[model samples]
Target chain A: MRNRKMAALTTVPYVIWMALFVVIPLVLIVVYAFTSKAGGFTLQNFSAMGDYAKVFARSLWLALAATVICLIIGYPVAYALSKMGPSFQRTAIMLLMLPMWINFLLRTYAWMSLLENTGLINTFFDNIGLFDLINKIALSLASDPSAYQPIDHFQMINTQGAVILGMVYNYLPFMIMPIYSVIVKIDRSMIEAAQDLGADSVTVFRKVIFPLSLPGVLSGITMVFVPSVSTFILSKLLGGGMNMLLGDLIELQFMGGAYNPYVGSAISLVMMIIVMICMTVMNRFGDGEDQAVML
Target chain B: MSEKLINLENIHKDYGGKVVLDNINLYVRDKEFVTLLGPSGCGKTTTLRIIGGFETPSAGVVYFDGKKINDLPPHKRPVNTVFQRYALFTHMNVYDNIAFGLRIAKVSENVIKDRVTNMLKLINLPDYAKREVSSLSGGEQQRIAIARALVNHPRVLLLDEPLGALDLKLRKEMQRELKSIQQQVGITFVYVTHDQEEALTMSDTIVVMNKGKIQQIGTPVDIYNEPKNAFVADFIGESNILDGVMHKDRLVSFCGKNFDCLDSGFEKDETVDVVVRPEDFEIVPIEDAQLVGTVKSTIFMGVHNEIMVETEDFTWKVHSIYNAEVGDKIGLFLTPDDIHIMHKS
Candidate 1:
């Protein structure tokens, strides 16, 4: 007990850092959301709920879409990784995380380059006689004189697909980490128990594995969904400002179009509330006594 | 009563570079209780798991009745195992855990209830039907495990140290309950345990194994009284094995003295271990005895006195009603029938 007290005293620096960096910032955000620059203490900041309503709806939907995509792509990969040997698991996860180590903007630019009209994909097709085939057949009526149109014909440079692609790529490891840890810790004997009870492979997965991995699913959803909602760079770089995503509008408020701290803080507060509500709903479904026991 | 229910033929198991079960073969007669008894890592559990279809033998075949079950999965087999930890589904209540097999068999809800109720009564746990298995006691969990296995009416029951985690008193109590349950079910039981006393008490036929090979398979009486070698003799019970040689019919020479033994098969001058139960030795007057010794020590047991006597060549242990103090001179007499002579294999 005395030693524990000494250890508690030793954590003073970390406790102060957490209060200053984390708690104070969150409290300040909530305080600033209601206080407006006009009356200084009016709910006028929330009065124009109409202006930010579209942003809230769009960002919430996009985050949900990205989380769903991550679930679809990440779950099977995590399950496959969990069944491998230790060396294979380590190397495979390292390779999956290799993209994250590169600069995030650089990787986003790489995707932009690939999807662009005059990018490597288009150049390869021109070199491979695709353009010649069109010209000879006179299907070239629609073809332009330029061999390649850089970001002119392809709309990928400023699209929602670009945002989703960026989100899935950036947040894939988050989806995998929780799910992989949970799946790997699943007892072999529980699956064996299901099998010995005459459940076939598909039935076993439906009855045992899926329901058992709900905690990881909920955690991964929170991890990917919360971050993707407010991401501005992906929409700015890939969407090319053509589709004004919620994140782009929020960035515009802080960076260029209007220096309205109150509106931006209100949007941020609403996003935080939506993420918390989703988390609470998830917790309600899988709280105290509902979890599947692997043992 | 079983008509050769399960048969295993020359099964081999290798893990990485080391072999765990080597060329194993055995058979389970219908309704007969057989125990695989051995020290740790002797491959008894491996053989049980193979029969349970949790493992495929590297070589040789496993047969259930007459059908080859070499490639069959565990769920496809007509066998159920009571694991050491019971391995009861903690997610379920007692009723659900028992009803799992029936549910998998796709029995109707009414039939599932009836079958689970019957099992609960059989295991003397009728009141525990709605209780979460995690809330049950160790002994209760054990009974629930037995009930779960029995509800399926499997052709054979595989028990891997079912009483291993219980306390001494509970373990002994469960041993009796398990034996009675086997008799009531009348199913072939293949039990695996390293506990010698559990094997001696519960098993009708015990297969003793060592170093991945079967040492001997025999009735408890045969295994105890007529052990095949030194390993079986030492493993089964108290064996006072003296290095001796058979000299002639019903006679052996040990401790630099010729004494009568209970062996007849060996030729004269064959090396053998002379085993005698402590109770078999009688202390007589030194004048008319075949062997004489001075009392080395005396231990007071409730029923009998354990006296150790030091002879000229060896120290002899005996359980006697007579009390003799240390340094007292006495004669040790053994009848030909009391001495058990086993060959050194």
Candidate 2:
């Protein structure tokens, strides 16, 4: 009885903290989502959400593309890192986490300068006569060479691809860390057992290694997808305020030209619900197995 | 006699200047249950792995069915292994774990179901087809590991201390079960274990090893009754080894007394080691005692009393059904056949 009381006492601070920061904010958001600017109950905020449908679609699509690309690039790197010697693995993991120590905004700003029209990449391309080579090929293929305008610098920044590249560059280490930790902890005898039972390398991987690493893959997808979907700064800085996402639209309602907290609260609630639904569906794939559900 | 199925010729294994196995030559016959018995770090498991194609000998060739299989990978070898910890795939059900090899070989689903069902029945877990691997107990997982390897019908089955993780009662039960399973399948089995009792209970041929060298290889009775040296005698069971001198054809001198023994092929006054099992001593009256001493300690060991007799030169361990109080005078007698003489190693 004394131990139980002590445990309950220890949890009081955390409970108070949650109530102050989390519960009250969630309650206030729900209240604002259902009320108008004049403090009267109304559903006008939700009815007005139809105007930002394209923003929602663009946010979800870019996040999904970035997540898929991260998985494609991260899985093999994690697998290779897991196979290295212990000292090498320690060094490699340190290198992977080194970039995360820098400020997130600073990293994204670095990408901004690198991807500008007169950036280092475009300068290098110009120095190598890459633009001339491309124009020559276009001239050779065109039926009307005079109508074709000569190409100058590649339009890399201020595009959806640049925003995705920023997200992927920032979040890839998150994907690889969990997968590498999981793969490194797998028992060595399991692979030996598979081979002893007449499984070749590919068959052993398909049957044993990949299935056991599903929980890690699921967690990696979550870590990369959640922040990418709700990010406004990357799209603003890299996409140059043109391809606005759901986060930017929500920010505009509260702090931009439109200053209505009711519509902002409604969009925030909808995005949270959609993300929760996506997570629920993803966790269904890991139903009977052991999974690390971060939420 | 059955034909020789596996031959390890002049095998030597070293790991970065440290020798793990030294000049080992062994062979296993078809349908014979062979055990490599030793303590930890004695290279018994390394020998078994070499035969299973998990390790390649540093200097020798491995022959499987009269063909050199030194370079063959484990997947191409017609052998399967039950690992020490059972290593079951936790993501798979019992049915899927057992059917893994068959599926890898691309056997049809109908045939795989039949074989898997038969293997489950053989391992006495017939209704556990849908049970997860994590839900099974240690013994149940051990049986499933065996069933998984056996479902492929490999020519040889290698077991590396498969029962080392179980309790005493469960290990005993699994020992008999593994023996019967090996007999029923009629496949060559190469088992590695450090437990002398388990090796004696299951193996048809026991290869006693120590310090990366084979001490002796024989039947269980021969290994127990006629150990090659003092190390073998002490390792297999409780025995009192003493330094002695072989004075003549049938006489040995130890504890400042000469005794008649059954062994005779030693030179005159040649120094030797003598072994006498603790249970071979009989409690006799002090008047008719060949050797007499005062009892130092007595322990009740369920089936017998273990008494320590402190003589003038040596403290002897003797097992007898009769009990004696500590510090009491006692006598011990031994027959001529009970005194085993061995060369000093």
Candidate 3:
């Protein structure tokens, strides 16, 4: 009885913390999603959810695109690193992962120097003479000069395209690491087995490696997509107000221009639900047994 | 006799300035079972990998059925490997595992089905076609690996310790199974293993390797009875080596006995080592004894007793079915056939 009481006492803080920080917020979000500011309880939040059609579509597109790019660029680098001798692999991965140790926002700020108006790219463009100031100014002029007039000041600084670039840069290593560990763990003999069976490298990769790397790929995708869907800082800093992704809209209602607590809670609730749904879909394709077998 | 199927000429492998395989020349005759026997780090697996096209020779050529396959990738090679882990395609069922190669070669669905079914029967796992590979036991998985590799119909099958993962009983069972399978498939089988018994029991030709070099290559009988050097003799079976000096053309003195052996061509009074098998000596009466020693201990080993005889010159063990009490004075009889002279390293 004493041991049980001690165990309960030790767990008391965590239980209370979970109830206070997790359960209450979740319950509040669900409650806010159903109720509205004007009345008691209704599907007003669901009705207002339609108001985010453009944001939803654009956010989904950019998130998916970033995730895809992450996988494409990260998988090979990870595989290459894994193939190196153990000592070399250890140092190389350490170097590759060093950038991740710093603050994520600082890295984003560094990319700002690269993508900023009259930044490195613009300076190159100035020398080349094909483009103008900020990444946004060049973008607005190229896409639609009439609706999107190029601002004299830091234009294109905050835009959907810039957000995607940030997302890709940020999530690429995450995509690579999981995929790399899996790829490295995959028995080299399986690839040989495939080939001895008369499979060219392409066929072996397709039939053996790609299918085996599915768990890592799916999880990598989930890692990138889920985070990108919720990420607002990049969109806020890089997307020049012409585009408003779901993250930006959530930021607006929660902490910025619009102080709509009900809408903010509703968006958070929806984002969590969507993330759960995506994870479930990924896990369904990534059968637990096959995933265990892959590594 | 089947023609030579695969030939490796002066193959050498160096990794980062460290030589893993040094000037390895070998040949695999058609439908023959060749085993590369070596201790760990002796480059046996590396040699097998070179044949499988998983690794390239630093300075040599591999000819598969008279075609130079030095630059060919593993998939393009006319060889499949039953990896030590039996690297079965876990994502695929046993049927798909067998059919993977056929599908890769663009065989029709109907043909693939037939071939896979036939292979499943060959490995004696027809009903297991639908079972996921991870669900299978170690022995079953090993058969699946063989089935998967064999279904491709390659000219050579490389088995790198395929039964190494199995228990001792299964290892013995699989050795027989592997030999029969090789005979049935009629493709050259290149197996790699550290176990002398497995190689001695299964292979037609055993290539003994040590320190990344081929020490000796011969038939199992040749390897065991007449090992070329100390390493080979010691590695193949239990051997008692005694330092002795040649007294005459056919006689050598060791363990306080002047034994007549067929071995000759040693300089008069030259120092040499004599290899004696424990089972070769027999217990005899004291009057007819060729060598005398006091029994130190008697170890009962089910069918036979291992008696350790301590003598003035050397300690020797003799296995006999006759009961001998511990610490008894025994006269050991060594026939001319038991004592073979070996080169001291």
Candidate 4:
């Protein structure tokens, strides 16, 4: 009884902190989403979201592509880390986390400098005469040298690919960490058992390792997908104001000439719902008490 | 003589400059059940792994069915292992787990189905085809592991402490079941364990090992009746080991008394280690016994009473059906055959 009383007393501060910081802001957002600028309740904010359908679709597509690319790259890296010696595993994990320690904006800006038309990547490509080879191919196809003028450098920045590159660079560690944690928790005996039962390396991975690591894969997908879908900073800097995501549109609503908190709140509410739905679906894959026990 | 199923010649294993197995040579005949018995870190598991093709010896040769198999990987070798922890695939059902190797072998669908069904029935889990491995009990999982390995039909099966996780009663039950299964399958089994009783209960031949070396290799009766050294005698069962002098052939002197023993060919008055089993000592009247002492403590084991008698030179353990209280003067008697003498090691 005394322990219970102490536990309840200790939780009072946290309850107050959450109510003031989290619950109040959420309540305010919901109220503003349903209220008009003139202080009257209305549903116009939701109806207005239809005007930005293209932005929403583009954001989802880019996020999906970035997520797929991260998984392709991160899974192999995580599996390799899981198989490395303990001393090397620790050092490699530390190196993976090193990029996350820098400020997010700084990392994206570094990508920007490297990806600009005359930047390091394009300069190296120009030095290798890759642009000249493409120009030569275009000339052969067009039958006119004047029609296919060779460029000095390739344009990589101010494009959808640049934004994706930024997101994959910044959020890849989040994907790898969870997957690596799950992979490392797998028992070594299972691998030996598979081999002893006549499974070759490829068969063991496909039949044993891949299936067992699905929960971590799901968690990584959700972590990278949700954040990339909602981000506006990378799109603004690397996308060069040409491509606007839902986050950029929401920010524009509250800060532009048409300063409307109601529409901003509505967009925020919709994004939060999408993230919640995503998490719910992913959680279903990792459900049941047995999965936790196995982990 | 039956054909040799597996032969390990001069196996030496080292990990990072530390020797785990040293100069080990062992042979398993066809359809024989051989057990490597030792305490932990005794390199029994290493020897078993070497035979299983999971661990290549630093310097040695392994022959499987008269073919050199040291260069073969575990997946290529015709051997299966039941791991100590049962290592069942958590993501798979019992049927799928048992069918894993068959699927890898690309067996026909109907044959895979028939084999898996038969394996489930053999393991006594006929209705557990769809049951996930996580839901099964330890014993059930163990049976599934055994079935999974046996379904592969390897010529030799290696088990590394497969019953080390079970409780006492369950372990005993599995030991009997395993022996019967070995006989029914008629395949060679190479079992490794630190439990001496389990080794003796299930093994046709027991290889006692310690400190990366084979201490003794014999049948259960021979191992128990005549251990090769002090370590073997003490490790197998309870013993009252004492320093003695071989007065002459067939005679030893200890505790200021000379007793006739069955061993001979020792130099006169040479120091030796003498082993007397607790059950070999018969309690008698103090005046008519070979040695008399006061009982220090008496423990009532279910089948026998264990009395610790402290004589002038050493404490002796005697097991008898009769109960004796603490502090009571007791006399112990031993025959010539009960005395086992060995050169001090």
Tell me the whole-model lDDT of each prediction, alpha carbons only: 0.83, 0.93, 0.84, 0.90
**Winner by lDDT between candidate 2 and candidate 1:** 2
Clashing pairs in 4: none
Q: Model 3 residue B261 lDDT?
A: 90
For residues A137-225, could you state the per-residue lDDT of candidate 1 as single tens digits? 55445476456433223345567888888889899888988888888887776777667677778877777787677778777887898
lDDT by residue (tens digit), candidate 3, B1-345 = 137688889988999999999988888898888999999999999999888878888999888788888988777777788888888898898888888888887899999989888888888888988998888999999999898888889878889888888999988877888888888878888999999999999999999999888899999999999988878987998887889878877899886668899888888888888888888888899889888888889999998898888888788888889898878898888888888887677
Residue A267 of model 2, lDDT score: 97
Measured with C-alpha atoms, the lDDT of residue B74 in candidate 4 is 92
Better by lDDT, candidate 4 or 3: 4
Ranked by DockQ from best down, the candidates are 4, 2, 3, 1
Candidate 1 displacement at residue B211 in angstroms: 1.2
Candidate 2 colliding pairs: none
Q: Which runs of model 4 end up more than 4 angstroms from their true locations?
A: A124-142, A288-295
The candidates' interface RMSDs, in order, read 1.6, 0.7, 1.3, 0.7
lDDT of 3 by residue, A1-295 (tens): 9999998899989999999999998898888877779858877766687888888888889999999889889888876787789999888888878989999989888888877886777666667654444545567557565565544333445666788898998888778878888888888878777777888877877889888888888878888898898887787667766667787788788788788878777877888889888988788888865552121
Which is the winner by TM-score between candidate 1 and candidate 4?
Answer: 4
Q: For model 4, how does the per-residue alpha-carbon lDDT over B1-345 read when each residue is reduced to its tens digit?
A: 237788889988999999999999889998999999999999998898888778899998898888888989899988899999999999888989999889888998899999999988877789999998989999999999999999989888899999999999998999999999999889989999989898888889999999999999999989999999999999998898999999899999999999999999999899999999999998899888999999899899999988899999999988899788899998889999999999998
Q: Write the per-residue lDDT of candidate 1 for residues B118-182, one digit (tens) a residue.
A: 88888888888899877899999999988888888888888988888889999998899889989
DockQ, candidate no. 4: 0.84
Candidate 3 Cα errors over 4 Å, as ranges: A1-12, A85-120, A131-155, A290-295, B1-3, B66-68
